[model samples]
Target: MTNSIIKSLSLPAPEEIEVAIRGQRALATYLSTRLETQKIAIQDADNNTHQIELPTSALTLLMTILGELAAGNAVQIVPVHAELTTQEAANILNVSRPHLVKLLEDGALPFHKTGRHRRVLFADLMKFKDQRDTNSQKAMQELSDLSQEIGLY
Candidate 1:
């Protein structure tokens, strides 16, 4: 996606932001206490209205994304099968190109070559990121436990 589109998605209109923040909490409550089936209504400028049913899982994701945008955090939605260039993959991972290359070589992340350039599947990148995050959380928890046992925390 272009930077402009990303920037726009990262922010909501002033009124929209307020609504989104409220919606985030409201959606969570509904998901927790009410039914999982939900429908959303859209109204066009001409006053034509349409309604669509959304799975609870999808609604949860939408609520979370909206909340993030309301808080001025950037969010990007990439199709699972999308192919990304080495640099694009690096940017997504917040790492340098060379580091991403190393991960690819180490089999920590998988990639395929198109001519001289390497391309990573969006799904594979996300898998690697999820595992890395889980590992980091585990390590932090271990450290915290050790510190507490040693009377350092």
Candidate 2:
């Protein structure tokens, strides 16, 4: 039998969160509290920047999530399409864009160009990422064995 979801744990509207935190704009205060309790990080462009020391956009996004939480709705969000440029895909893969372009050119991942713009599918990104993760695990095991044989720190 499927477990029934509790109403107390749900996400709400981003816009509503924005309105709720409008006046003081204490994004860090609000987010730190939520993040400390929840093992979730806000994937936001604004949160990546700190010169201003405030994540207005992230705040808005979180507000919506908090509102949903208050409303007792459970949801998990993911991208429908990768819709990323070569540079963006490289960033997602933590690799150089030139390398990603070469992979695309070599047919490693399915991608298409619209005029001059190239876009990669999210599914392809996920597949490549899984492969990379698996390879990393294999390499780590090999290195650990080598380290033990050599008695290297």
Candidate 3:
């Protein structure tokens, strides 16, 4: 998602964020504690009402996503099977277009040729990004441990 879109999704004020956070937390707590309250009520702007039931796992995931948004974090929901252009994928990864192309060429990321252009699947991109993030975290942790052992931390 573009920064402008993300900015637009951001909470208008800190107080709104706080209120949203609390509301999500409260709903989560209530639903978890009250087993009888299986379905949630959804009200539309037109005053229409809908109710849907969710599994506990799904409810937990919803709560987490809402919590992140309520904390003023920009969240983008993309379909797993979505295909993205090279520039869009690079933007998501916060990398240069050339670097992304290099990765695709080097077999670091999988892509398919659409005519003359490369198209990357959202799922594959996410898998690669998750692996890279895990590796970076591991390296950082090792460095911190080494520093601690040497009395530098």
Better of 1 and 2 by lDDT: 1
Q: Please give, for residues 1-153, the per-residue lDDT of candidate 1 as tens digits.
A: 222212344355688778877888877765642557788777999999999888877887888787787796667777788888878888878999999999999988888887887888889988999999999999999999999999998
Cand. 1 Cα-lDDT: 0.79
Q: Which stretches of candidate 1 lie over 4 Å from their true place?
A: 1-10, 22-39, 53-57
- Residue-level lDDT of model 2, residues 1-153, one tens digit each, is 012222244454665445544533444354653332333334456666323344455555666655554455554433646366777678768899999999999988988887887887667788888998999999999999999999995
TM-score of each: 0.72, 0.47, 0.73
Root-mean-square deviation of every model: 3.8, 15.9, 4.2
lDDT of each residue in 23-124, candidate 3, tens digit only: 788877766744533678889999899998877666766777778779787666677787888888898899999999999999999999978989888899
Per-residue lDDT for 72 in model 2? 50
TM-score of 2: 0.47
When summed lDDT is taken over every stretch of 10 residues in candidate 3, the lowest stretch is: 1-10
Better of 1 and 3 by TM-score: 3
**How high is the CA lDDT of each candidate model?**
0.79, 0.64, 0.80
**Which is the winner by TM-score between candidate 2 and candidate 3?**
3
